[model samples]
Each structure stands twice: as C-alpha cells, then as structure tokens.
Target: MTMTVRDLRPGVRADFEGFARVRHLALPFYLVTPDSLVYDLAHAHPASHFRPLVAEEDGEIVGTAQVGIVHDSPEPGQGYVNVYVHPERTGRGAGTALVRAAEEHLAGVGATKLFAWVLDEPGNRAFAERHGYRGSRSAHFLRLDLTNGTLPPRPPLPAGVELRTGADFADDPRPVFELDSETMSDEPSDIDYEFTDYEAWLEGTWHHPLFSPELTSIAVADGRPVAFSAARTDGGTRYGTVMTGTARAFRGRGLAKLAKADSLQRAREAGLTEAFTGNDARNGPMIAVNKWFGYEICATEVRYVRELG
Candidate 1:
C-alpha cells in the first residue's frame, strides 16, 4: 500500500490512537497517550509552530513525527524533527515520507538548523545520513524492573530538610517553577533556552495530561523547594521520571538523590512495575545515581543535525 503523510487531526479518535500507538511500538519507554498527545497539540506555544504528523498506509498509521521550532531557545532558527515508524513497518517508505514532511514544515517556518534523534542502530544512522543529518551528541535510556528488582531503602532527609510530594505545592507552584528554571538552564543540551515565561511553563509542564503530581518528590529547605524529581505515569503500571535536578546551592548534598529515592518508593507502593528515565551520556552524576537505583541502559539514540541555507 502507498503511504501518505498528513498532520494529525486533533478530534479524530483514530488519529489520536494511531499516533500514540506508533510511538509506543517504536519507543516503548516513552510516556505518551491519546490524551497527552491532544493536550500537547492544544497547549504548545504559538511561536513553537508544533505539528504532529503521521504516515498512513491503507488507513493505518505506520509512522509518526513531532516537528517543532525551538521557541524557548536563545537561538532563533533552531528546530527539531523526531520521527518514529512502527517497528513492524520498517523498510517501507513510511519513515522517509514522514521525515520529508517534517523537514518541509520546519524549513518553511524559518528554521535554519534542524536536529533529529536517530536510534543507535546501523540502519537508523545510515538513514539520517542519507537525509543530510550528521551525528552529534547521544543520550541513553535506562529502565528498572520495579516489580522484579530491589530498590535501595529510602534515603534519610538531613536535619532541617523535609521531603514532600508535588501535591504539596498545589496552591502555589512558583517556588517549584523557580527551581525548574534554574536547573533547566544548567542541563546539557545543544540549544540554549531561557525559561522566563511562567504561564508557558505551567501549560507545557505542570498541567500536562500525564504529569503525576503525587508521584513527584520535592526536597524543601529554608521553606522553599531546593530539589525535585519530576515524574509522569501511564495511570497504570508504567512510571517515568522526566527530570531530577538540584539547585546549585543545594548540590553535592544528596538532595536530588533523596528526592528520587522517595519518588521511586512511592511508585512501587502505588503498583507501578516499570520505571524509566533518560540521561545525556555526558551527565556522569545522574548516570551514577540511576545506576545506584538499579537502572540498566536499555537503548541509546544519537542526535543528528543539518544546517540549511
């Protein structure tokens, strides 16, 4: 069957399920659902120009791509295109068609440099190179079998330090936002971002469909949030930590570790069986922490970049 690519329709149940299914099939560790997909499409910043595209083959979605401009990056012309095709449908034209459509959308929206994440497999690397992208930095996805593996005992909080869940900040999340902004600026990434808009952050992160406030843990000191382990859940057995960071003033004190350990125990007791997280290959401290919690490297993906005229 011939493949055709089109922007995913928001209200259509088929498109919603198809897009999420394709993502789960290609990258099982990713936390996504039909609700989250539609919420992201509706709440993304206008400047981002985000589009979720799908490649359909005989009425079935065989490929998916998330194309967007880096609206928060300090650099204006940077953009990203992440394409994933159904594992069973590889070698077909689905991937190629999805990439072409994504690239065109990004280029037309004033992008000069485009970035993509290609799996570490030989075929995936060759495919990116065939489309003008060159390899850059890489990241690792780690997984823990919560039900079968043993997790370290919850870390004891230091004197004058208290551990709390994200639900504790329901009335006012400004302090948490401040901590998130500071830590985000220090994260390792090719593009530099300025997270100055609180409203935008609330829309994009705090209110997202899958954000599991009860599962997230925060470390409080001096009456404010000093570190946090942000989490998302599939509402059933799967759990993922999106970010675990500590303020510069609180680093080296094991605050981030305490928050994560607390969060993990919460997930396990809540009946979650799988735990997943990603760390940049260059982030040694985080890798060490995850390893301490019994997470093993499950997959690696290389970032590919292309500069256009």
Candidate 2:
C-alpha cells in the first residue's frame, strides 16, 4: 500500500467525512461529523495557522492530524499536532507519516514546542515517546449508560437561583460565554490559554452543528450564569458534555452538580441513551462530581509535549 501524507482540502466534502470518520473511530466520545469539521476549519482563527493533515493509503484516507499554533496561549511558539488513525488502519505506518508531516508543518511555522494527546494505552504511549514527546498530564473520558443508569435527584435550587437551558440565552449568549470563559481560564492544563475572543467562541462553539442548546443546562445565580454543563449530541442516542464548570465565586456550592444533573436528566428524557464526559486526572473536584453521577472512566489520554526547533 502506498501511503502519502498531505494537507486536507477543506473544500473537498470527502476529506471532511474521512477526517470525521478517522476521529470517531479513534476517539469514540467526541461527537463529530462532516458539517462540524467544515465549520471548524472555516471558522478557525487565521492566527492559529490551523492545517488539517491526512494520510492516504491507496487513495483511501486512514489517518488525520490537526496541526496548529496555540495562538491564544500566553506563551508564544506553542503549537499542537494531534494525530488520529482509524483503529482498523493501524500498523500501516500511517500514524508515523502523518506525525512527521504535522511536526514539520508546525516547526516550519515557528513552533518552539509541540503537544499531542495520546491515548493512555501502551502502544499509543510508546508511539509518542518514540517521537520525542513526553507525557505531561493525563485526562479521562467517562461514560454513563443514561438509559439504564439512575441519575441522582436534582438538588433544590438555591434562593434567587434558577435553572435554564442554554437555549434560554439565545437572545444574549454573552452571559454564558462570559461564564464559560471565566471557568475555562481556571481549568487544569499545561497550556495557559487566554480566551478573550468572544466572536471566535461564537463562531467555533455556539454555532457549531453538534452543540445542543436545549440539552445544555445553566445555573443562573441572581440573574448571572454561575455554572453550566454544555452538551453535544451525535444526532442519535449518544450525548456528551463538552464543558462543565462553575465560576470561581460559585465553587463549593452544588451549582455545578445541579446543572449537570438537570442536563443529564433532560438528555435521557430526549431519548439519549449514552452519555460521555471528560475530566482532568488532577481535577479531583470535578471527577468526584462525575462519579457522584455514576460516570465511569472508559478511557484515558495523556498530553505529550516536546520542544521543537
């Protein structure tokens, strides 16, 4: 089989579907489709220099890599090259070729450091180590059988607090965006991200095809969105929480739990059978909350970093 690595033509519909296929096979939780992939590439910030790479074996795409500079990071020259190969297509050297192409692309674009998320499996970890990447931090993907699993009862809302769907903020999503920005700033990670671009958020997140506004739950405290559980759907029985966080001032309260519970309950009611979420291994608080909701770790990934030229 002849394997070659090249840039994915965003204008090509097949490229979008192939990329989404590889990602869905490699990372089962994250909901993605051709529409979402095209939307992401179209809305990606120019500063990011985002280039999607694909590996083709005999005219069939088997692997993909999303390579880009972390333009929003406080530290410059930081970039990322996340590679994913179709599970059935492994051992064909597609991953290696794609990684080489992505690394070269980022390095040529002035990247001084590169990060990649590698599944915690032994083979995946060994592959990253072979590419000079060292494990930095780890995170877990959790799953809950919403149809069969019982969710804890919703906690009573605090005084002056209200529960609302993300759709309720359709007229002015700035509050939810602001709340998300604040909570995301405090999220545990190796990169220090600065999310000051609300327009970018709207383009990449709010308007994304899979974002389920009706399924997302927000906790409003005194007319302000204090906590939220943003949801994404696979347009089927699968549902996932893309982001769940509480504002700094709102931590220690049960708002996050309340929001997640409300979201999960509604998802099940809407016929969603499988629920997925993620949590940083070091984030004990959030992990505890997920556990309380009966979510179990289904897979883990480690962020691998390497200093580049």
Candidate 3:
C-alpha cells in the first residue's frame, strides 16, 4: 500500500473523522473533533491561507499536517507546518509525504520560514534534523488520571475573589476574549500573535464544538475575569485543558491553580476519566500548578524551524 498526501475533503464526513482520529492518536494531549476540524477549515481567516492535509495508506489516514502562512504576524514570509504521524504507523513514508506537500504549499505562498514540532524522542528529532530542520524550544504533555488520582480539594475562595464557569459569560464572551488576549500575548512562543479579531475568536474558539464551557473555570475579581483555565472535552471520557493562564496582575495569587482545580473537578463530575494539558518547558508557575494536580509528564516535543526559499 503506497502512502500519498492530499488536501483534506472538508465536505466528506469520513475524511474529516479520519483526520481527527489520526490527530488524536498522534497527539492525545490535544482535543480534536470532526466538527472542529470542519469549522477550522470553513471559518479560518482568508489571510491565513490555512490548509489541512492528510496522508493515507491503504485507505487509512495515518498522518496529518496543518500548513499555513503566519498571516497574523507583523513579519512576512513566516509559515508553519505541524505534522503528526499515527504512533502505530510510523516507519512508513506517510510522514515524509505530508512534510513534502506542506513545504511545497507554504513555499508557493512565498513563506520563507517554516516551523514544526517533533517529539523529543531520538528517532523523531533525528528525522527532523535529517529533513533540514533545527531544534528549538520544547513543550511538555502532562496527564492526570482523573479516575484514580487525589486532586486538590476545592478550597475557599480568596477575599474579593469569586469562582465562575465560562458558561456564565454566555451572554457576552467579549470579557473572556479580552482576558484571553491579555494572557496569550505574554505566552512564550516563536510567533507573536495579537488577538485583535473578536469575530474570529467567536467562530474559532467560543463556539468550537469541543469547548466545554461548563467545565471551564474562571476566577473573577471585582466583577472582572482575572484568571481562567479553558476546558475541551472529547464528548467522552477525555478532558483537556486547552489554555490555563492568569493576567499579569493576578499571577502568584494562586488564582490560576484555583481555577484549574475547579475545572478539573467539574470535568471529573461530568464523567471525564482522563485529563491532559500542555505546558511550555520554561513556564514554572503553571508547571507547578499542574504538578499540584498530580499530573505527570507524559511526553515532550521540541519545536523545529526550517528556512524556506
């Protein structure tokens, strides 16, 4: 069975399902659903030129890639192509085919730089190095066994601090949007992102199929959101923290940890058996918070960069 890469068929249910399946198996820490995949394809900003592709072998999708230019960046020619091959299907040509196709698409769009994330395992890193990519920053995947772990019991809310669920802001999520934007801007990343487009956030995040507003915790102070831990569910037993952060003013007050704990407990009560989150290796405060939640380091991936002509 020969492996081949092609554009994802957004209109085909099976195609999108297969794509989401491969991504979940490859990066179990993140949440992906067929609906979310289709929404991303259909609602992405025109400037992004975002294209998702899949590598198929014997009618099975064994690899996936998200290829696009970094349209939001102030600098031009920056692009990204994060590819993941099914863990059980490595050693095949699927990964290479996906990479080649993504590179060609990005280069055609005049993207002069490409970024990717490879597992920190020796073989994965070596494959990236062999493909003309250089290693850079790393991030970790953390997992907590909600079915058999001792989570920190919810504590008393601090003076002047109140806990709320993201669903509380269903009437208007702009406050949450503003809070998210403030925290995201300070996050460590190769690409600088500015969340100036509220409409885009609404379509891409607020209404995302996987977003679990009921399980998402927010800490409000004086009626303003100061910290948050966003939740995404697989609509099954899996729960993932999509983003956990606190405004600069709220850092070190244990507000982020409190929010995460609240979210985790809500997820558990909702029958979620497993929890997963990703953290940049250098983020000590957030790492400590996850550690407090009894999360263990499950895997690591290093970011890689390639200069495209």
Q: TM per model?
A: 0.99, 0.98, 0.96
Ranking by TM-score: 1, 2, 3
lDDT-wise, the better of 1 and 3 is: 1
Q: Against the unseen true structure, what C-alpha lDDT does each candidate score?
A: 0.94, 0.92, 0.90
lDDT of 2 by residue, 1-309 (tens): 899998889689999999999999999977788888888888889989999999999999899999999998889999999999999999899999999988888888899999999999999999999989999999999999998897888899888889999899999899999999998899999999898889988987788888999999999987789999999997889999989999998788889999999999999999999999999999999999999999999999999999984
Off by over 4 Å in 2: none
> How far off is residue 219 in model 3, in Å?
1.0
Assess candidate 3 and give its TM-score to the true structure. Answer: 0.96
- Which of 1 and 2 is ahead in TM-score? 1
* Local accuracy of candidate 3 as per-residue lDDT tens digits, 115-203: 99888999899889989999999999999999899988986799999999989999999999999999998898888887888988888
Ranking by lDDT: 1, 2, 3
RMSD of 3: 1.3
Each candidate: RMSD: 0.7, 1.0, 1.3
Q: Highest TM-score, which number?
A: 1
Model 1 weakest lDDT span, ten residues long: 98-107
Candidate 3 lDDT trough over 10 residues, lowest sum: 69-78
